[model samples]
Target: MNRSSFRSVLYLAAILPFFFSDCKKSSSGPASGSGGNGYYTRFKMNGSSVEYDSQPFAGITLLKSDSLYTCVMVAYKDVNAGLKNAVTIIIYSANPIAANVGYNDPLKSRRSNGIMVPQTTIFWYDSTGTGYLTAGEFADNTGNTGIAGVIANAKLTITEMTSASVKGTFSGTVYRSDLARSAAITDGEFYLKRSQ
Candidate 1:
């Protein structure tokens, strides 16, 4: 074969895999049946209702990261047609104990004995318009541009947990890391099907 033809063949070989691979739809979150009547996670943020109730698109995952267990849930809430909004919650546990009802943990500023309460991070992403509300931003709700909040007075509860599903509630108060402002979160609950 001519050198030009050989080079063209090599280029196509390299590019074809990527083209085909891209056809697969990437999973948006944990493994749960889409549109199942069993999954829901909702809360009030800044006096507005934030919910991730769609099935198949919302799910939960529990995996160990180093010595700590990582529990994560992602909910896809439709804010518009053809566009999506998402809320992500990640919690770091010192142990694998099921977070069942009335299960509560205090969130402190420093870690102690492998336990870091308030070691959780929550993210709110509006893929269609407004920016995201990160764990740090939630901790810095005082309207001060120069200072961050110190996370404290936080409590998280897992109302139910199993290998196949998980349910929980959480609330807390966070002060800016700079001590500039603070935000309050209350009455939060989530029930998700475990895919992993």
Candidate 2:
């Protein structure tokens, strides 16, 4: 597999187990507008609103390795039938993240504490079985060109972080595997608990 494909597989491998665990939905009512009711993940993709209610399976996770800290946040929903949609964001930093901060340039790596931290990445898996990546890279398929994809702009900010939950917002443009199409995600907001 190509590097991008391999990375995609690795990411899926890391998170699938958490998703499969038993989960329960929150008892709160549905969300309204951008903020209300209870914890929620909502965004507009291509001007279409998509929201995922609070569930134990969708939340944030923190991992540590030597000096690198990785924070992963996931928002997932089973829209209908067997169709599933999900959005995941992965952030890498040199130190433990404990406050409000913005990851503006997800395509640019930064050096910290003598270590090279990788750029943040976002992934979208639509209910239609299509995938989009902010990095603009994917496995080879029919009519696919082996070129790095372009990301016009992407930003994810951690607006609030507490021992109980993490609140954030994100906006970005992501490209399909073959670069044939792009999706704009806006007005993204998520309030998720820390995954145990």
Candidate 3:
């Protein structure tokens, strides 16, 4: 495997255990809009809307292993006072992802950027207190407590992007491996500076 493939595998290895483990929901603070920083991402977690911006959003990072591999990362933390809950989104692609194009399968894994799957898997790190990462799927969580595929029908839409910055909107259903529960995440948008 190449460097990108190696990194991807490493990440998968690190988070696999969390998929089978049980998840303890952490308390979250008030969701706020952009704090003067033109970036904010909001989504409904089990029907409740949560927002994160530059102030509590922490930072965003972009990484590339080669021409065929790219990763976009966003982090959020410290919302409520003394609250340890945090969230992260890692978007990985094989080809050079451009704006306006809908990348499907936001929950399935591909061997490489050129290779396409029915779904694209996005890494989700829920570091509320007991930090855990999972290759969650994009699927609806209505009455089910455990997810079959983790996530389904995951789609990411990029509204703006550049070497120095990336802006986009993403919406999907997320599934948890620890349990059969899922969350309907919609109207999720973000604008972030590219970090080296």
TM-score of each: 0.54, 0.68, 0.57
2 or 3: which has the higher TM-score? 2
Evaluated at residue 134, the lDDT of candidate 1 is 26
Candidate 3 colliding pairs, count: 22
Ranking by lDDT: 2, 3, 1
Residue-wise lDDT of candidate 3 within 79-124, one digit each (tens)? 3322233345555455566678676553333543444333334433
lDDT winner: 2
Candidate 2, residues 37-153, lDDT tens digits: the string is 366678999999988653512333344333456667765664221224766666666556655676655233334444333335666777775667564223221213345454445
> lDDT for model 1, on a 0 to 1 scale?
0.46
Error of 1 at 64 (Å): 6.2
Per-residue lDDT tens digits for candidate 1, residues 13-42, read 233223222112335643333345767767
Q: What is the C-alpha RMSD of each candidate to the true structure, in Å?
A: 13.7, 6.4, 9.3
